[model samples]
Target: MAAGTGGRGRRWVTAASPVLLPVASAGLVLTLWWGAVVAFDIPRILLPGPAEVVSELIRLRHRLWEQGLVTLTETVVGFGITTVAGLLLGSAIAASRIVDQATTPWLVAFNAVPKVALAPMLVVWLNLGMQPRIAMVVLVSFFPVVLATSAGLRSTPVELVELARSWDASRWRTFAKVRFPYALPQIFMGLKIAMPLALIGAVVGEFAGGNTGLAFVIRTASAGGNTALAFAAIVVLSLMGIGLFYAVVALERLLLPWVRAVTA
Candidate 1:
C-alpha cells in the first residue's frame, strides 16, 4: 500500500509539474528583477522594481481594462477577418493552378513589404481611431493565415485524394470532408503565429496615431516619466498576448482532438 501511495504521489507531482514549472520560472525572473533593482538602487523613474509596477497595475486597473478592451477588440476583429479571407483565398489558390500562378507572386511581394512602414499609410487612408488599428492587425496577420492555409491544403495526402476520387466524391465533398479537416493542424499553426502579430499590429497602429489602447497607455506613461506605469502597461499587453495565443491553442485542441491524440 505504501509503495502504491508513493507511486500515486509521484504521478501527481509529474502531472502538476507543467503548471508549477512556469510559475516557478516566472517567480525566479521576478525575484532576479527585484534584486537587481535593489542592488543597483535603480531610480523609480528609470527602472522601477516589480513591486512598483504591480502597484501601478492595481492603482490604474480600471484605465488599463478600458484600454486593454480596445486593443482586444482590434485584435479579435482583425484576426477574424484575416482568418475568413485567408481561408477563402487559400482554398482558391489550392484548388486552381491558374489562381496559384497568378496570385502567389503578388501575395509574396505584399507580405515582403515592411508592415511597420504601411502602418502610417493605413492611418492616412483609414483616418484616426480603430479603423487603422484593425487594418494594421489584418495586414500584419493576413499573410501567415493565407500561407498556412494554402500549404496545408496542398499538403493533403495524394493517397487520400485518390481514394476520395475513386469513391466518386465531388470536389467540394472531398474538400469539406477530407482536405479541410486534414489541413486544420497547419491552419491552426498559422493562427497561433498570427495571434501575437495581430496584437503587435494593434499596438503599432496605436503608436502611429491613437489616444487609446495599451500602446497609447505605455506612450503616455513614458512621456510623463512614469516608468512604472509604462512597465505595467507592457506587462498587461504581454499577458493579453499570452492569453490570446492560448485561446487559439485551446480552440485547436477542441477542434482537432484527433491531431493531439495522434501526436500523443
Candidate 2:
C-alpha cells in the first residue's frame, strides 16, 4: 500500500511540475521584490514596487497597448526582412568560398559597430519612420541568421554529399532535399537569437526620437519623472521579448519534428 501510494504521489508531481514550477518561481520573485520595497522604503522615483508598477500599467493600458503594437509591428517587419535576406545570403556564401570571403568581413564589421551609434544614421538614411525601424531590426538580427545558416550548410555530412553525388543529383536537388532541410535547426537557432535583438533594434530606432513605440513611452515617462510608468513600459517590453522568443520556439517545434528525435 505504501509503495503504491508513493508511486501515485510521484505521478502527481510529474503531472503538476510544469504548471507549478513557473508559478512558484514568479511568486518567489514578487515576494522578494515586495519585501525589498517595504524593507528599504524605496521611493517610487528610484524604483517602484510591484503593486505600483502594476497599478501604473493598468492606469495607462490603452497608451501602452497602442505604442506596444507599433513596436511589435516594426519588430515583425524587420525580422521578416532578416529571414528572407539572410537565407539567400547565407546560402550563397555557403555554396561559394569566394562569396564568403568577400562578404564575411563586411558583415562582421557592421556587427562590430555599436547599433546605437548607427541608429541616427539609419534614421537619416531610411527616415524617422517604420523604414528606419525595420532597417535597424534587419541590421541587428541578420548576422546571426546568416552565420548560423552558413555554418549549418557547411556542416552537412560528407557521407550525405557522397550519397547524393552517387545518385547523380543536381546541385539544386541536393540542396532542396538535404541541405536546406537539414539546416533548419541551425536556422531556427539563429531566429530565436534574433528575436530579442529585433526588439532591441526597434527600441533603439524609437530612441532616435520617434513618435510611437515602447521606447518612446519609456523616454517620455522617465522625462516626466513618472518612474512607475517607465517601469510599466519596461514590463510591456519584457513581455514582448518573451512572447516573441517563444513564438520562434513554437515555430521550430511545429516545423522540425526531427529535432525532437535527434535530441531524444
Instruction: Name the candidate that leads on lDDT.
Output: 1
Q: State the lDDT of candidate 2 residue by residue for 30-63, as single tens digits.
A: 8999999999998889889999999999998999
In model 1, what are the clashing residue pairs, if there are any?
Answer: none
The CA root-mean-square deviation of candidate 2, after full C-alpha superposition on the true structure, stands at 1.9
Error of 2 at 11 (Å): 5.6
For residue 114, give model 2's deviation from the true position in Å: 0.4
- Tens-place lDDT digits, model 1, residues 119-216: 88888999999999999999999999999999999999999999999999999999999999999999999999999999999999999997999999
- lDDT of model number 2: 0.92
Model 1 / residue 262 / CA error / Å:
1.1
Give the Å shift of residue 192 in candidate 2: 0.7
The global C-alpha lDDT for each of the candidates, from Candidate 1 onward, is: 0.95, 0.92
